[model samples]
Target: MKLVSFRASGADRLGIVFPENKVADAQQWGAANGMDVPDSMLGLIDKGLEFRDSMSAKVKATAVDDNADYVYDYEAVKILAPMPKPARNIWGIGLNYTEHVAESARSLDTDNKLPQECIIFSKPTNTVIATGEAIKHNGNQTQQMDWEGELAVILGKGGFRVKAEDAMDLVYGYSIINDISARDNRRQGQWIVSKGMDTYAPMGPVLITPDEIEDPHNLQIITKVNGVEKQNGNTKNMLFRIPEIIQDISSVMSVDPADIIATGTPAGVGAGRDPQEWMWPGDEVEIIIEGIGSLKNPIVDDTY
Candidate 1:
């Protein structure tokens, strides 16, 4: 089942998207039926698999009943990031794609070396923006703003020193993320400032449950700027992969429920181009992943 967080009546509410382009307000359905459903996505995720499964089954059954009072057209509501306010900063992998590593080297952004271990970074919670929202193009801060489209994993369970083989058990769902970066904002060797600026992370249309996806590594990830395709790659090309990423991070710190991990992006980013393209105030960026849907956002000048 596809899950979403959308704004209705000036408040964020949990929703389930039907295949027919309709959204069912889960909170209202739960309240009406006397089910103990959470009002927020994070709360639902924290309820554990048994509860989620029970809720999903009921919601699916209700859809069959054809309830219209709590359902709305998909285009009518304002969609927010699956987790509008993440519990913590988002964990990101850097240069996890071989081609991206090479391109970063070519662009003088990093050394031409394949990582011996997973390269991890973090983006502050304030960086997140939902689909159709505007990505702030702060010209006074950067002129070389770029994009990196990647697949993100949302964990459902927490574990310390989780075995790589058992890592999949922690996955709750998947979503798309555009890792926006300001090429000229690098300070020292850290990425927090360059990549963690406000409105730099564009994520979500919906989060697809693990049961719907056969193999996460086999999906395709494509990115486009305006109407022109910029990056076209597959998850199979990822150097670290999901299991290894989970194992690597959990070896040091616990992986908790609702924690977001943005698997590194593919090549063909604006900085990797020959002439070096950058996003401007009027441009639009869209990222499409095979199992997940498209996440599109426009660029706007930052007044602040």
Candidate 2:
């Protein structure tokens, strides 16, 4: 099921997106149909599987019923991040792809050596944004704005010292994130400052539940800028997959429900290119993941 957080009629509500672009408003439908449901994506995630399974069944049944009253126009509702307000910082793994590592090395004139383990980073919760939201172009602060399209994981259960083999059991679903970065900050080794700008992390048009995606590893991830394809890669290229990522992080910090893990990006980021193409006002950045969906955001100058 493709779960979503959306605002309709000025109120935020949880939605289940069915094929054909139809969305069922959980809060409204549950109220009208006498079925209780969570009003937010975070609420749903915390409610556990029984609740989600029941809600999914309700969403599916009510979607196909011509007499159902809660189906709304997908285009009319404004989409938000899977968890519009994250409970904590979004965890990220850096240099987890070989090609990306090589490109990054070449760009920074560093050794073209891949990390033996995942390089982790974090994005402030405030950085999160949704599809169609404008990526704040900090034209004044820094001119080297870049985009890193990555596959993000949402955890269902909180855990510490989790095992790699058991990682999938704790995962809730998956979404797309544009890990926008300021290359200048990165050049100075200020990762958080470079990648944590508010609205820089453009994510979600749809959040597909784990059941819908049979295999996350084989999915194709593509990023395009203003209609020109820039990054093209498959998740299979990831040097550190989901299992290892979960094990690596959970060993140090407790992973919580609604926590977002951005499994490193692939090659072809602007900073890694020959001419180092950067995003400017009026440019559109789009990240397309195989099973999930497209997250497209326009760049708007947020300069003083």
Candidate 3:
């Protein structure tokens, strides 16, 4: 099932996106069916898998019912990031794709050798913006802003030292993330300021449960700027897959519910281009991941 966090009636509510582009108010559906439901996406995730499974079953069984009162046209509501306010900064995996590593090496003037392990980075919670939102292009701060389209994993259960074999069990769902970066702002290899600027992370159109996806690694990731395709690659090219990523991070720190881990982008970013492409005002960026959905956003100049 496709789950979403949307704004309707001047309030944020949890929703389920059904066929025909309809979004059902999940809380209201639960209430009508004599089932208790959380008002927000994070609240529902915190309820654990048993509750989520039960709710998913119920939704699937009764979705065909004529529940016009709670269902709204998808376009009528404003969709927000699956986790609007993540409990912590979003975890980012760097150099996970071999081709991306090579391209990055050329752009950064570093050695092309691949990392022996997953390279982790963090994008602050403030960096997140939902689909259709504007990505702030601050000319003073960065003249070489670039995009990295990645698949983000949302953790359902918290744990330290999670084993790779059991890592999949901790996942709540998956979404798309555009890891916007300022190519020139890297200060001595540190990326927090360069990549964590406000509106830098564009996430979501919807969150797809694990049940809907058979193999995350087999999916295609395509990115486009304006109307032109920029990045076309598959998750199979990832040097470090999801399981190892979870185990690596969990070995050092606790992975908690609502914590997002972006699995890194593919090759073909603007910085890797011959002439070097950069996004400016009046441009739009769109990321499409197979089975998940499309996350599109406009680029706007920072007036303040």
Candidate 4:
């Protein structure tokens, strides 16, 4: 089932997108129709995976009555990251794509550039923004702003030392994450400040269950800036797949339910380009992931 979190009429609600791609208030239906998912996605996660499964079944069984109307149009609500306010830490795997690694090499001196093990980093919770939100195009402070379109996994169960074989079983769903970065800060040496700005990470229109997608690592990812296609790539080219990432991270710390793990971006980020182009105020950035959805964020002048 396609699940989403949206804000409408001053209240935040969890919902299921009908086959028609319309919204059905899951929280309302769950309460009224004996369906028992707690009001929030966090509540559902805390309730456990089995509880979520039971809830999904009940939601699917909810019949559309002739007299009942769909709660809202798809476009009527403001979509938030499917699981906003995620449990704790947000982990990101970098340069997992071969082409991205290759392109990155060209940007560095021959002596300093080469493919290695996955480059991982963390983004504070404050970095997340949703589709249609404005990205802070903070100039001067961050003269080189770049976009990295990535596929992110949301965990359904928390665990330490998780095995690769069980990695998929722990996933809650999948969503798109725009890992926006301040390239100059990256060059300055610490990634946390460079990539962790508020509104730097824009995620979601919705999250799709694993069952809905045949292959998580094979979808097409494309990014457009002002209607111009700047990045085009596929997940099939990932150098290290999801299982490896989970195993690597889990070995160090516990991976919690609703915890987001960004799988890294493909080639074509602005930082890895010649004459390096960067985003400026008035630029519109849109990322499309086949079978998932699109994320659109406008680059606005830096107020700070």
Candidate 5:
């Protein structure tokens, strides 16, 4: 089932997309009537993996039920990040692609080159933005801004010291993550602050179940700025796969359900070009991954 978090009335709610992409409110329907699981995607995962599976099945089955309580057209509502406020830190891998690594070498001082081991960073919870939201393009603080299109993994079960072989079992589903970056701030210091800017992490349209994607790492990740194609690559070039990343991180800390893992962006970023170009105000950025829907946002003049 393809799930989404959307705004209805004045609040955010959980929903499932039906045959034609119609929205079905999982929570409101459960409250007014009854449900097998909680409304929020995070809540359903907290209930355990079995609960997620059962609820997903029920959501699919309810599509044909004449008494279905709540159903709305796809365009009738605003799409929010599948998990508005995830419980754990958002972990992101950097320089996992050879070309991206090579670009970093050219842009950074010798001392700032890629580490021998996996290079990991974190994005705060507040950085998470819903699909169709505006990304600030102000030039006051940062002179250069860029985009990275990557496949993001959302965890379903909590686990620490997980084996690489068993890592896939903890995943809830997949979503496209636009790792918006501030090139200036990033080159100045670490990514926690630069890449963690408000609305820097725009994710979603829908969270597709793993069953829908036979091979998560086999999809294409493409990005465009103002209708001009800028980045085109596939997950096949990843140096560290999903299972290896999970194992690498889990060995140190527990990965809670809903904690996002931005597997790493593919090559072809703006910084990788001979003459670097960055996003400016009035520019539109669109990120699309196979099987998952596209995430589009306009870059506005950010006063902040």
Candidate 6:
């Protein structure tokens, strides 16, 4: 199921993506049907299977219940990040892809040995940016900004010390994130300053449930800047897949419902380029993960 959070007429709305790119307005549909479905994505994440089943049934019923009038043209509203602001920092892993590790090492003129374990990082809540928003260039703070297209996993159920085998139970769904990084500020091995800037993570168009994805680790992920394909790789190639990542993260901290996990990127980031490239004003960046949908955002100076 493809679920979304949209903003229109000065209010936030919950929706389900239906056939032919149509969006069924969950909030309005519930009110009309005398049902009290969760109106927020966070509520849906915590509502669990019963809510999902109910919503799915209602969405199907709307097709024939001509009076429902909940389905809307997908373009009528502005898409917000499925989970606009995660409860906490978004968990991130670096060097999880061999090619990325190689490219990064080459760019930094360092050793190419693989990270011994899951190298995790955190993207504070402020980094979250919706698909249609602008990725701030922050030209005043840093002159160069780069992008990392990644598959983001959202947790529906909170868990701690979770086992690798059972981690799937904690999954809510998946979205795409552009782990936009500021190469200049990523100094002295500390990425917090470089990665924590506002609008660093451009996420979503919608979130797709596990049932919609046959194999979470086999999707084709691609990133294009201004219509030119840049990063292209398959999720199956990640060194530490979803299971391992969940297990590793949950062991250290309690991952709450609605938390996000940005599962690293494949190679071909701007920083890895021979001469390096930085996103500038008006550059459109599109991160497309097969099945989840594309998240496209434009680059703009911090001023506006």
Question: What TM-score do all the candidates reach, one by one?
Answer: 0.96, 0.95, 0.98, 0.93, 0.93, 0.94
Candidate 5, residue 250: Cα displacement in angstroms equals 1.0
Q: Alpha-carbon error at 302 in model 3, in Å?
A: 0.5
Note the residue pairs that clash in candidate 1.
none
Once fitted onto the true fold, the runs of candidate 4 whose alpha carbons sit more than 4 angstroms away are 58-62, 65-70, 108-116
- Candidate 2 per-residue lDDT, tens place, 1-304, comes to 8889998889888987877777778776777767677788888888886666676666667544334667777887888888888999999898888998899888966458878777889999999998998989877677999989999999889899999999888888899999998887764675898888889788897778877888999899999999999999999999999999999999998898888999989999998999889999999999999989899999998998
**What are the Cα lDDT values of the candidates?**
0.90, 0.86, 0.91, 0.82, 0.82, 0.86
Worst 10 residues of 3 by lDDT: 59-68
Those runs of model 1 whose alpha carbons end farther than 4 Å from true positions after fitting are 31-34, 60-67
Candidate 2, residue 204: how far the Cα is off, in Å: 0.1
Q: Against the correct fold, how does model 6 do in TM-score?
A: 0.94
Per-residue lDDT tens digits for candidate 1, residues 1-304, read: 7899999879789998887788878877787767878889999998997787777677667642246577888889999999989999899999999999999999955979899899999999999999999999988889999999999999999999999999998999999999999988888887888899999999998988887789999889999999899999999999998999999999999988999999999999999999999999999999999978999999999956
Q: How close is candidate 2 to the true structure, as a TM-score?
A: 0.95
Alpha-carbon error at 196 in model 6, in Å?
0.9
Looking at model 5, how many pairs of residues clash?
Answer: 0
Model 1, poorest ten-residue lDDT window?
A: 59-68
Candidates sorted by lDDT, best first: 3, 1, 2, 6, 5, 4
The sequence of per-residue lDDT tens digits that candidate 4 reaches over residues 1-304 is: 7888888888888878876657777777676777666667777667777766777676577664424443777778878877777667579887788777777777733223434666778999888888998999777669888999888888888789988888888888889999998877775456898899888889997887777789998999999999898899998988778887887888888888888988988989897788788999999999999999899999999756
Per-residue accuracy of model 5 over 172-239 as CA lDDT, tens digit each? 99999889888788645677767888888888878998888889878999999988988888898888
Which wins on lDDT, candidate 3 or candidate 4? 3
- For each of the candidates, give the backbone clash count: 0, 0, 0, 0, 0, 0
Scored by TM-score, the top model is: 3
| Cand. 2 Cα-lDDT | 0.86
Inter-residue clash pairs, candidate 4: none
